[model samples]
Target chain A: MKNIYVAFCCEYKKVSHSKMLWITIVLFTFIPMMMGLMIYVVRHPEISAKMGLIAAKASLFGNADWPAFFGILHQSVATIGLIGYGFVAAWIFGREHSERTMKDLIALPISRSYIVTAKFLVAIVWCLFLSVILIAVGLMMGKWVGISGWSHEVFVHGMTKYFVTSFMTLLLITPVAFFAGYGRGIIVPIGFVIITLILSQFIAIAGFGAFFPWAIPGLNTVPEGTEGMQLFPISYVILVLTCLAGYLGTLAWWRFADHHS
Target chain B: MEEIITTEKLSKQYKDVLAVSDLSLHVRKGEIYGFLGLNGAGKTTTIRMLLGMINATSGSAHINGMKVHAGNTNLWKDIGYLVEVPYAYSELTVRENLEIVRRLRFLDDKHVVDAIIDRLNLTQYAHRKAKNLSLGNAQRLGLAKAMIHNPQILILDEPSNGLDPAGIYEIRELLTSLSKDQGVTVFISSHILGEVSRFATRIGIIHEGKLIKEINSEHLEQLCKKRLRVKTKNNILAREVLLQNNLICEEIHDNMFELESESAIANPDEIATLLVNKGVPPTMLNVVEEDLESYFLRTIGIKGGAK
Candidate 1:
C-alpha cells in the first residue's frame, strides 16, 4: 500500500505540472462562455438581429431562462465530458509510450499494476477537476448573462443532474484507458473516443440509448422523461460491466503482456 | 565467486525472427561483465529479458537466485538498469526525473536526488527540462537515475553512447570503483568493444544472437594477435632474410616487414640479429599487439583473417 501511495504521488506530480492540464481547463471554460453568449443574444432580439447568422444559431436553444441554460450545460457535459475525460486517460497512460519512458517503469520495486492504478487515479482526479471547473464556470457565466427563473430548488435540481451526468461520463472513460494500453499510444485511444462519440449520437437516435454505454449519460440528461430517452436499470449494469472489463483488461495487459518497447 | 546473474539457454522468438537464441552466461559478484555485440545482435533483447520487460520463449534468467519474471519485483529493488537510448519524462526537469525514480524506488532519503545530481555533474542542469538537454547530458541523467539508489547490480545497455571521450572515461572510472570497492555487479552491454575492454572484468561476445566467445579482460592482451613489425633501411633484404629462415613475412604498404609467426614474434631479437647479419640493419623493431577493435572483429570473423 505504501508502494502504491508512492507511485500515485509520482503520477500526480507528473500530471499537475503538465501543460495539457491547463490547456484542458482553459478549453472547457470556453464551452460555458459560448453557451452564455448564446443566452445573452437570445435575451435581446435587437442584438440577435445585429449578430445575424450566429444569433440564428444561438436562438436554436429555444429560451434564455435558467432551465434552458442548465439543460444546455447538462447535455454539453454528457458529450464534451466524454472526449475530455478520454483524452485525460489517454495522456496519463499513453504518455509513457509516446515519451519512450515505458521501459523505465518496468523492473521497478513497485508492481506494474500499481503504476497502472496510479495513472488511472491521476486521470480520474484530472477529469473530476475538469468537470467541476466546467460547472463552476458555466454557473458564473449564466449569472453574468442574468438568465431568469433562478431558485434554490431549481439550482439544486440542475446541479444534481450535472453531477450524475458527470459521474456517468467518468465511468465510461475506463474503456478508453484500456485502449490507451492496448494501442500503446494516444492516437489509437483518441480515435476510439471519436468513433464512440459519433456512434453514441447514432445509437441514441435509433432509440437504443440505454443499450449503449456511451449513450446512457446523454439519455439520462434529457430532462427526466423524454420519449425514447428513457434509461433502464440495465443501462447502468452495462456501463458498470464495461468499466470492470476495461479496468481488469488494462491491469492484465500491464502485468502479463510483453513490453518490447 | 558467486554468480549474481545467470541465464540458461534463454531464447526469444518474435514471430519469425529470433531476437535471442540459446544464450547462456553468468555475471559474478563484483565483476563488470561487458555484454559485447554489434547492432541487432540481441544484446538489448537479452537485457530486456533479464529485466522481465519481455518474456523469453524458452529457458530462464535468474538474478540473485530469484527467477526473473514480472512478479519478481523484489529482485529489482537491488537492480538498476538503463536500456537502449535512455529516455526520461521530457517535460520534467532533470532533478524531477531523478526524483520520480527515487520515489518509485522507495528511497526515503530526499538528499539522494541532489547527491546524484552533484555526483553526475548535473548540478548546473538540475532545473533544466530533459528535452532541452544535449545527448551527453541526457546520457548522464540516465546514468544518474540508474545509480541514484546505489543498487547492488546495474544493467546498462550501450551506456557510453553519445558521450564525449572524457565523459566516457569518467563513467568507466565510476563503474570500476563501484565494482571494485562496493561489490556492485554491473552487466553493461555495448557494441564498442574498445570502451568495454577498458573496465570490464570479463566480456562475453555475442554475434547474431549467439554467445560466440567469453574471455577474461586480463587474458585479452595475450589472446589478441601480435606481430613482429620490422622496419629496416633495406626492406627487401629484411624480408628475404626472414623468409629464408622460415619466418612467414608480409610487406605492408609502409615499407615494413610483418612477421606473424609465433616463433618470430616470441624471438624478435633473433630476427633482428639475422637481419643485421645480412647487413639490412633494422631501423625499427617492435611487436605491435592488435587493438581490441581489431581483435573483436577478427574473433567475429568479419576481418577475413584465418581463425
Candidate 2:
C-alpha cells in the first residue's frame, strides 16, 4: 500500500502533469462560462426561449442527469486521464526497457505483482486528481447556473454512479496501460486507442457494445419520465464486469506477457 | 545445503518467438549464482518469471519451493529484487523510498531500516531526493531499498548497468560478501561476465533465449582452459616441432603461438625448456589461465562481443 501511494504520487509532483490539471480546470470551466455568458449578452434571450430550448433539446442535453454529467466526466477522464495513465504507466515500466532500472527494482525480495498493482493503483490515484478538479468545477457550475433542485436522491445516486463509473472506466483504460507499460514505447498505447476507437464502430453493432470499455463514459442516458426514480441501467452492470475484466487482464498479461524491460 | 531457488524446464514464449526455452536452474542457499548472457538474451525475462512477473509458457519455477504465480505469493516476502538500474520515486527522499520498501514488506523494526541506511552510508543523503543523487548514490539507495527488508533471496538483474568502475567494484564486493555475511542467496543476472566471474560460485549461460548450459564455476574454468603462449625468435622451427609432436598450436600473430596446455604443468620455465629443446628459446613464454571473456566468446560462438 505504501508502495502504491509512492507510485501514485509520481504524476502529482511532475511539473508537466501538474500544469495539465491546472490547464484542464481553467479551460473547461472558463470556456463553458464564456459560452453561457455570450448567449445572455448577445441574444438577451427570454426565459421562455431558454426553457423552450431545454424542452426541445431534452433528448440531447435538457435533462442534464447525473449520467449525463458523468458521461461528460468520462470523456474528460478518457481524453486526459487515459493519456496520462498510459503515458505515466508507460514510463513506469518503460523506464526498465529504456534503461537498467528494472534490474534495480525486480531483484528486491518484493513480488512483481505487487509492483504492478502498485503502479496500477498509482495511475488511478493520479487520474483521480483530474476528477477531483472536474467535480469541483461541476459543483461550481451547478451553483452558478442556479440549477438547484438538489435532492439527496440525486446526489446519492449520481455520486455512486460517478465513482463506480470512474473505477470501472479505469479498469477499461488500464489494460491498454498494461500494454503501454510492457511495450515501453511512447506511441504504442496512443496508437492502440486510436485504432480501437476507429474499429469500435463496426464492433458496436452488438447490443453489448455498451459493455465495450471504450463506450463506458456514455453508458447512462436517462430516457423520458424516469428521471426521479434511481434505476441504474443494465449497461451500468458492465462497470463491475469491466473492472473485474481490467484487473484480470492485467494479471493475465503479467502472468503470460513478456517483460521487454 | 538447502536449495533456495529452483526452475524445472521453465519456458516463456512471445507469440511465435520463444524467449526462454526449457531452463532448469538450481541456486543453493547462501550462494551467489551469476546468470550470464548478452543483451536480448532473456536474462531479465527469466528473473521476471521467477519473481512471478510473467507466467511461463511451460514448466514451473519456485522460490523457497513456493511455485511462482501472478500474485498472492509468499515467496515475495522471502525475496528482494533489483531489476536493472536502481529507481525509486525521483521526487521523494532516499529515506522515503527505503521506508516504503520496509513498510510494504511489513517490518516493524525501524532500527533495522536505520541500520541498513547507516551501513549503506546513506544517512547523510537520507533527506535528499532520489533523482538528485548521483548514479552511484542512486544505486546505493537501490541496494539499501532491497536490503531494508532483510529478504533471504536477493535477485539482482544487471545491477551494475549504469555504475562507474568504482561503483561496479563496490557493488561486486557488496554482493559477493553479502551472502556469507548476511546469509542471503543471491541470483545476479548480468551481461557483465567478468564482474561476476570471481563473484559467483555457479553460473548459467543464456544464449538466444535458450539456457545453453549450466555448469559449476570450476567446470566453467575447465572449459575456459588456460593456454600456454610461446613466442620464439624462430617461429617456423617452433611451429614445426609443435606440429610434429601433435601439440595443438594456434598462430596468434606472426611470431606468437598459443597452445592448449595445463598451466600447473606447463610453466614459463617448462615452455622455455621445451623451446630450448627445439633450439629456439629466444623470446616470451607465458602460461595463462582461460578467462571468462574467451570462454564466453568460445561458448556462445559470437566473435567481437567482448565485455
Candidate 3:
C-alpha cells in the first residue's frame, strides 16, 4: 500500500510537470469558450448578419437561453471530453515507452502493477480536473454573455447532467491506456481514439448507439424526451465491462508481458 | 565466499534467433565479474533476463539465493542494475530524475539523493534537465540512479559507455572501491576486453550466445601467447640459420622472422649471436606478447577480426 502511494505521488509529479497537461487545459477551455461565442451571436441576430461566416455559423444554436447554453456544454463534454481524456491517457501511459524510460521502472523494488495503477490514477485525476475546469469556464462565459431564463432548478439539472456525461466519457479512457501499452507509444492509442470517435458517430446514426461503448456517452447527452436516444441497462453493463477488461488487461500486460522496451 | 549471482542453463529464444543459450555462471561476493562478448553476442539479452525484464524461454536466474521472476519484487531490493543504454525522463532535471528513482526504490532518507548527486559529481548539473546534459554526464546520472539505494549486488551492462577516459577511470576506481570496501558484488558486461581485464577479478567471454572461456585475471597474462620477432638484412639466410640451429622460425612478413619457440623467446640474445656468426646480423630483435584484443578474437574462433 505504501509503495503504491509512493508510485502514485511520483506519477502525479511527472504528469503535473509535463507541458501536455497545460496544453490539454488550454484546449479544453477553448471548447467552452467557442460555445459561449456562439451563444452570444445567437442572442443578437442583427449583428450576426453583419458579421462574416463565423457569425452566421454561431446562429445555428437556436434561442440562446440558459438551457441551450447548458446543452452546448453537455454535448461538448460527451464528444470533446472523449477525445481530450483519451489524449491524456495516451500521453500518461505511452510517454515511458516513447522516451525509452520503461526499462528504468521495470527492475525496481516496486512492482510494475503499482506503477501502472498509479499512472491510471493520475490520468483519471487529470481528466477530472479538465472536466471541472471546462464546466467552470463554460458557466462563467455563459454569465458573461447574459443568457436569459436562469433558475436554481435549471442550474442544478444542467450541472448534474454535465457531471454524468463527463463521468461516462472518462470511463472510456481505460481502453486508450491499453492501446498505449500495446502500441508502446502514443501514436497507436491516439489513432485508436480517432477511429473510435468516427465509428461512434456512424454507429449512433445507425440507431444502435447504445450497443457501442463509445456511442453510449454521446447518446447520454440527448435530451430526456428525444426519440431514439433510449438506452437499455445492458448498455451501461457493456461500458462497465469494457472498462474492467481494459483495466485488468493493462495491469496484466505490465506485470506478465515481456517488457523488452 | 558466498555466491551472490547464479544463473543455471538460462536460455532465451526470440522468434528465429537464439539470444542466450544454456548459459550458467556464478558471481561471488566481493568479486568483479567482467562479462565480455562481441556485438550481437547475447550480452544484453543475458542482462535483461537476469533483471527479469524479459522472460527466459528456459532455465532461471537467482540473485542472493532468490529466484528471479516477474512478480518477485523483493529480490530487486538487493540488486542494482543498468541494462544497455540508460534513459531517464528527459524533461526532468537530474536531481528530479534521481528523486523519482529514490521514491520508487523506497529509500526513506531524502538526503540520499543529494549524497548520490555529490558522489557522481553531478552537483554542477543538478538543476539541468536530462535532455540538456552531455553524453558523459547522462551516463553519470544513470550510474547514480543504480547506486542510489546502494544494493549489495550490481549488474551493469556497459556501464562505462559514453564516458571520457578520465570519467572511465573515475568510474573504474569507484566500482573497485565498492567491491573492495563495501563487499558489493559487480557483474559488468562489456565488449572492450582491455578495459574489463584491467579491473575484473574474473572474466567470462561469451561467443554465439555461449560461454566460450572463463579466466581469472591473474592467469590472463599467462594465457596470452608471446613470441620473438626478428628482422634482419638477409631474411632468407636468417631463416635458414635459425632452422639449422634447431630453432623453429617462420617468415611472417618481408625480411621478418616470427619465432614461437620457448627457447627463442626466452633467450633472444642466443639467436642474435647465432645470426651474427652466420653473417646475417639481426637489425631488429624484440619479444612481444599478444594483446588482449587479439587473444579475445582468437578465443572466439575468429582470426584477427575475420570469421
Candidate 4:
C-alpha cells in the first residue's frame, strides 16, 4: 500500500508538470474525442455500406463496424492511441534528457525501478481515461446520429480485436516504453518504434505481422467467438505489465542517476 | 552512521569519450556534499550514474547501503532530487504539476508539498502554470518537486544555475536549513565554485573524468586565495614582474597581468604599488579574493588544460 501510494504520487507529479500538461491532456483526453469524430464522419448515411462494411468499418472504426459507442472506443485504443502516444511519450521521455531533468530525479531516495513503474502506470491511466471518455462520447454520438443499438457483429468483433489486441501490443511495445522511459533523447527510441512499426507491416506481408509488434491490428483479429477476449482480462494486463516495466525502469534509473545528474 | 552513498571506481564511457573515469567517492549520512567541476567535466555524467540513469562501464554504487537496482528503488522514497532543470509538464498549472508528482511519488498526504510550498514561498504562485514561472521560479518549483516527498536525501544538480542573487541566497539558505534542521543529506553540484561553496559542507572537484580533489570546506578556506589584476605599461614588464615574484599569472593580456597571490606574506596590492612607484602608471590595480573561481580554474585546468 505504501509503495503504491508512493508510486502513485510519483506518477501524479508528471500530470501536473506545466510543460507537458497540454500534451498529456491532449493525448489522454482529446485524442479519443477525435477518434469519435472520425468514426462519426465515415459512418454517414451517404457512405452507407457500399462494400457492406469492410470499407465502412475502415472509414469509421478502422476495422470494426461497431455501433457509434463501441466504434469510437475501438479506434482510440488501436490506431489513434498509437499515433498520439507515440509522439507524446517519445517527447516526454526525450525531454528528460533534453531538459536535463534526469540528473535530479534519479538521485532521490526512492527506488529507481519504482519510478519507471510509476511513469508506465501514469501512461496507462492516461490511456484508460481516454478510452473511457471516448467510449462515452461515441455512445452519445450514436444516440445523436440515431444509430443507437446497431448490432453489427463485425463491429463487435473488430472492437473486441482492438481491445484485446492492445494488450499484446503493449507487451510488444514494453521495450519501446522502456527505451523512451530512459532514452531522454528523441533519436534512439523514436526511430526504433517507427522503424519497427513500418517493418512489422512489411514483414506481415511476408506473413510475419503475426509476430510483428505492428501486428496489433492483426491480433485484434477476431479468433472467432472469443471476440474482444483480451480486453476484459488480457490486454489490460499487458498495459499493467507495460506500466510495470516502465516503473521498474524508472527505479533502475533513479538508483544510478546520481552519476548522470 | 553508515555512508549514504559510496562509489568504488565508478566510470562512464560514451562510445569514445570517457565521461567519468574510475572514481571513488564517499558521502556520509546527513552531509551536504558538493560535486564541483567546470562545464563538461563529467559532473552531469557523474550524477546520472549515481541515479542509475546511465550504466557505468565498470564500478558499483550503493544508496543507503543497498546496491543500486530495481528492487532498491523503493529506497527513493527517502530521496529528493532537482536535476539541471526541472522536467515538468509545461501546460499544467503549478498545482497540477505538484499533484502529478505527489501522486507519482505515491504521496497521499498533501501536507508534505503544502509544507514545501510554504517553505519555498510557492503557494502564492501555485495556481499559475509551471511553464509560466520565470527561471528562478522554475528552479523553486523544481526544488519543490524534489522535496515534496519529504525525502531524507537530496541529490540536486546545479540548483542555483539560473537564478538571481536573492533567489540563489534563498535556495542556499533553504538547503542549509534542510541539512541543519531536518537532517537531510544533500548531494549537490555546481560549476561555479563560489556558488557551491555557499552551502556545501564538503566539496569534490572532478576534472576530465577524474576525482582530482576532495576537500572539506575547512581545508578549502585555508587555501589562501587572492586575485590580483595588475596593469603595467608594457606586457613584457608585467610578465617579468609576475614571473619573478613566482606568481603564476593566469591571464596575461596586453599591458595587464592577472594572477593569484602565491604566498601568505606577499601583498598583491602592495606589489601593484611597487610597480607604480617603479614608474609603471597603474591603470587598474585590484586584489580580489574570497571565492573559489580562480582556485577552481587552476585546480581543474578547465577544458583540457588550455581554457
Candidate 5:
C-alpha cells in the first residue's frame, strides 16, 4: 500500500509537470464548446446565413432543446471520450518507453506492478477530469444558448446517463494501456485506438455492439427503446472481462516480459 | 571477502542469437569489478539480467544470495544501477528528477538529493530541465540518481561516457573514493580497458558473449608482453650481429631492432656490449611494454583494431 502511494506520488508529479495534461484539458474544453456552438446555430436560424458549413452541420441536431443537447453530449462523450481517454492512457504508459525511461522504473526497489497501478490511477483521474470538463462546459454552453425544456428530472437523468456512458468508455482504456506497454510507445496504441474506433462503429451498425467491448460504450448512448439498440446482460460481462484482461495483461507484461527497451 | 554479486551459468538467447552464454563470475564486497567488452559483446545484457530488468534464459543471478527476478523487489534495496545510456524525464529539472528517484527509493530525507547533486557537481544545473542539459551533465544526472540512495552495490554500464577529461578524472576519483571509503561494491562496464585499468580492482573481459579472461589489476601488468627495442646507428650490421649471436631480432621500424627473446630483454646491457664490440653501437635501447589497448585487442584476437 505504501509502495503504491509513493509510486502514485511520483506518477502524479510526472503528470503535473507535463504539457500533455493541459493539452488534454484544452481539447476536452474545446470539444464541448464546439458542440455548444452547433446548438447555438440551431437555436437561432438567422445566424445560419452567416455561419455557412457550421450552420449546415448544426441542422443534423434537429431540435435545439435540452434533451437534444444532452443526447448529443452523451454521444460525444462516448465517441470523443474514447479517443481522448485512450490518448491519455497511451501517453501515460507509452511516454516511459518513448523517452527511454522504462529501464529506471523496472529495476527499482518498488514493484513494477505498483508503478503500473500508479500510472493507471493517474490516467483514470486525468480522463475523469476531462469528462467533468466536457459535461461542465457543455452545461454552461446549453445555459448560454438558452435552449428550452430545462427540468430537474431531465438534468438528473441526463447527468446519470452521461456519466454512465463516460464510465463505460473509461473502462475501455485498459486495453489501450496494455497496447502502450506492448508496443513500447504511443504511436502503436493510438493506432490501435483508431482501429478499434472504426471497428466499433461498423460492428454497432451490424447489430453486434453488445458483444464487442469497444462498441459497448458507444451503444450505451442510444435511447433505451430504440429497436435493435438495447444491450444484453452479457454485454456488461464481456466489457468487464475485457477490462480485466487488459488490466491483467498490462500487469503481467510489466512483471514478466523481457524489457529490452 | 564476501561475494556480494554472483552469476552462475547465466545465458540469454534471442531467437537464434546468443547474447550472454553460460557466464559465471563473482564480485566480492567493496571491490570495483570492471567489465570490459566490445560493442554487442553482451555487457549491457548481463547488467540488465543482474538488475532483473531482463531474465536469463538458462541460468540465474543472485545478489547477496537472493535470486534476482522482477518480483524480487526487496533485492533492489541494496542495489543501484544505470544501464547503457541514462535517460530521465526530459521535462523535469535535475532536482525534480533526483527527488523522484529519492521518493521511489523510499528515502524520507530530502537532503540526500541536494547532497548527491553537490557531490556530482550539479548544483548549478539543479534547476535546469533535463532536456536542456548537455550530454555530460545528463550523464552526471544519471550517476546522481544511482548514488542518491547510496546503495551497497552499483551496477553501472559505461558510467564515464560523454564526460570531458576533467569530468572523467573526477568521476574516477569519486568512484575510487566510494569503493575505498564507503565499501561500495561497483560493477562497471566499459570498452576502454586503459581507463578501467586505472582504478578497477579486477577486470573481466567478455567477447562473443563469453567471459574469456578475469584478472586482478595487480596481475594485469605481468600479463602484458615486454620487448627490448634497440635503435642502432648501423641497423643492418646490428641485426646481423644479433642474429649471429643466436638472439632473434627483427627490424621493426626506422632501423630499430626489436628483440623479444627473454635473454635480450633481461640483459639489454649485454646486447649493448655485444653491439659495441661489433662496432654497431646502439642509440636507443628501451624495454617497451604493451599498452592495455593493444593487449586487450590481442586477447580478443583483434590486433591493431582489425579482426
Candidate 6:
C-alpha cells in the first residue's frame, strides 16, 4: 500500500507537469462550447440562415430543448470520449517508452505492478476530470442557449446517463494502455484507438454493438428502448472482461516481457 | 571478499540472435568490475538481465544471495543502475526529475536531491529542463540519479559516454571515492578499455556474447606485450645486423625494426652497440609496451586498430 501511494504521487507529478493534461482539458472544454453554439443556432433559425454551413449542421439537433441538449452531450461523450479517454491512457503508459524512461521503472525498489497501478489510477482521475469538464461546460452552454424543460429530475437523469456513458468509454481505455506498452510508443496505441473508433461505428450500424466492447459505450447513448440498439447483460460482462484482460496483460508485459528498449 | 553480484551461465536469445551466451562473472564487495566489450557484444543485454529488466534464456543472475527476477523487487532496494543513454521525462526539470526518483525510492530526506545536484556539479543546471540540458549535463543527471540514493551496488553501461574529458575524470573520481569510502560495488560496462583500466579493479572482456577473458588491473600492465622498437638511418642493414646477432627482429614499419626477444628488450644497449658497430647506428631505440586498447583488441582476436 505504501508503495502504491509513493508510485501514485510520482505518477501524479509526472502527469501534472505534462502539457498533455492541459491540452486534453482545453480540448474537452472546446468541444462542448462548440456544441452550445450549435444549440444557439438551432434556437434561432433566422440567424442560423445567415450562418450558412453552421446552420445546416445545427439542424441535426432537431429541437432546442433540454432533452436534445443532453442527448447530444451523451452521444459526444460516447464518441469523443472514446478517443479522448483512450488518448489519455495512451499518453500515460506510452510516454515512458517513447521517452525511453521505461528502463528506470523496471528495477525500482517499488514493484512494477504498483507503478502500473499508479499509472492507471492517474489515467482514471484524468479521464474522469475531463468527463466532468465536458458535462459542466455542456450544461452551461445549454443554459446560455436558453433551452427549455429544466428541472431537478431531468438534470439528474441526464447527468446520470452522461456519466454512465463516460464510465463505459473509460473502461475501454485499458486495451489502449496495453498496446502502448507492447508497441513501446504512443503511435501504436493512438492508431489502435482510431481503428477501434471507426470499427465501433460500423459494428454498431451492423447491429452487433451489444457484443462489441468498443461499440457498447456508444450504443448506451441511444434511447433505452431504441430498436436494435438495446444493450444485453452480456455487453457489460464483455466490457469488464476486456478491461480486465488489458489490465492483466499490461502487468504481465511489464513483469515478464524482455524490455530491451 | 564476498561476492556482491554474480551471474552463472546467463544467456539471452532473441529469436535467432543470441545476445548473451553462457556468461558467468562475479563482482566482489567494493570491487569495480569493468565489463569491457565492443558495440553489439552483449554488454547492455547482460546488464539488462542482471537488473532483471529481461529474463535469461538458459541461466540466472543473483545479487546479494537473491535470485534476480521482476517479482523480486526487494533485490533492487540496494541496487542503482543506468542503462544505455539515460533518459528522463524531458519536460521535467533536473530538480523535478530527481524529486520524482526520490519519491519513488521512498526516501524521506529531501536534501539528497540538492546534495547530489551539488555533488555532480549540476547545481547551475538544477532548474533546467532535461530536454534543454547538454549531452554532458544530461549524462551528469543520469549519474546523479544513480548515485542519489547511495545504493550498495551500481550497474552502469557506457557511463563515460557523452562526457567531456574533465567530466569523465570527475565521474571517475566520484565513482572511485564511492567504492573506496562507502564500500559500494560497481559493475560498469564500457567499450573504452583504456578508460576502464584506469579505475576498474578487475576487467572482463566479452566478445560475441562470450566472456573471453578476465584480468586484474594490477596484472594488466604485465600481461600487455612489450617489444623493443629500433629506428635506424641505414636502409636495410639494421634489420640484418640485429637478426645476425641472434636477436629476433622484423621491420614492422618504414625504417622501424621491432624485436620481441627478451634479450633484445631487456638489454637494448647490446642491440645499440651491434647496430653502431655494423655502421647502422640506431636513431631511435625504445621499448614500447602495448596499450590497453591494443591488448584488448589482440585478446579479442581482432588484429586491428582500437575501437
Best by TM-score: 6
Query: Considering only the true interface residues, what is the Cα RMSD of candidate 1 after superposition?
Result: 0.7
Worst 10-residue lDDT window for candidate 4 chain B reads: B260-269
Pairs clashing within candidate 6: none
lDDT of 5 by residue, B1-307 (tens): 9999999999999999999999999999999999999999999999999998888999999998999999988998888898988999998999999999999999999999999999999999999999999999999999999899989999999998999999999999999999999999999999999999999999999999999999999999999999999998888889999999898887786767798999889999999999999998899999999999989998999966789
DockQ of each: 0.76, 0.21, 0.77, 0.35, 0.85, 0.88
Ranking by DockQ: 6, 5, 3, 1, 4, 2
Provide TM-scores for the models.
0.93, 0.72, 0.96, 0.69, 0.96, 0.97
Clashes of each: 0, 28, 0, 85, 0, 0
What's the lDDT for all of these models?
Answer: 0.91, 0.66, 0.91, 0.66, 0.93, 0.93
Each candidate's B-chain TM-score, in sequence, is 0.91, 0.87, 0.97, 0.82, 0.95, 0.95
How big an interface RMSD has model 3?
Answer: 0.8
Candidate 4 or 1, higher DockQ: 1
* Model 4 global lDDT (CA atoms, 0 to 1): 0.66
Which 10 consecutive positions of candidate 1 chain B have the poorest summed lDDT? B298-307
Task: Give the alpha carbon lDDT tens digit for every residue of A56-114 in model 2.
Answer: 43334333444444444544454444444445555544544554444344433445556
* The TM-score obtained by chain A of candidate 1 when compared with the true chain A: 0.98
lDDT of 1 by residue, B202-229 (tens): 9999988899999999999989889989
Which is the leading candidate under DockQ? 6
Model 5 Cα lDDT, one tens digit per residue, A86-181: 999999999999999999998888989899999999988998999999999999999998989999999999999999999999998899999998
| Candidate 5 TM-score, C-alpha based | 0.96
Better of 4 and 5 by DockQ: 5
Best of the two (2, 6) by lDDT:
6
Candidate 2 stretches with Cα past 4 Å from truth are A1-132, A135-233, A237-244, A254-256, B111-113, B209-224, B241-248, B261-281, B302-307
Candidate 4 residue lDDT tens string, A116-233: 5666666666555555555555556555654444666755664555556454444444455556645656666677677766674576466444434454444354343443322233
Give the DockQ (C-alpha) for candidate 2. Answer: 0.21
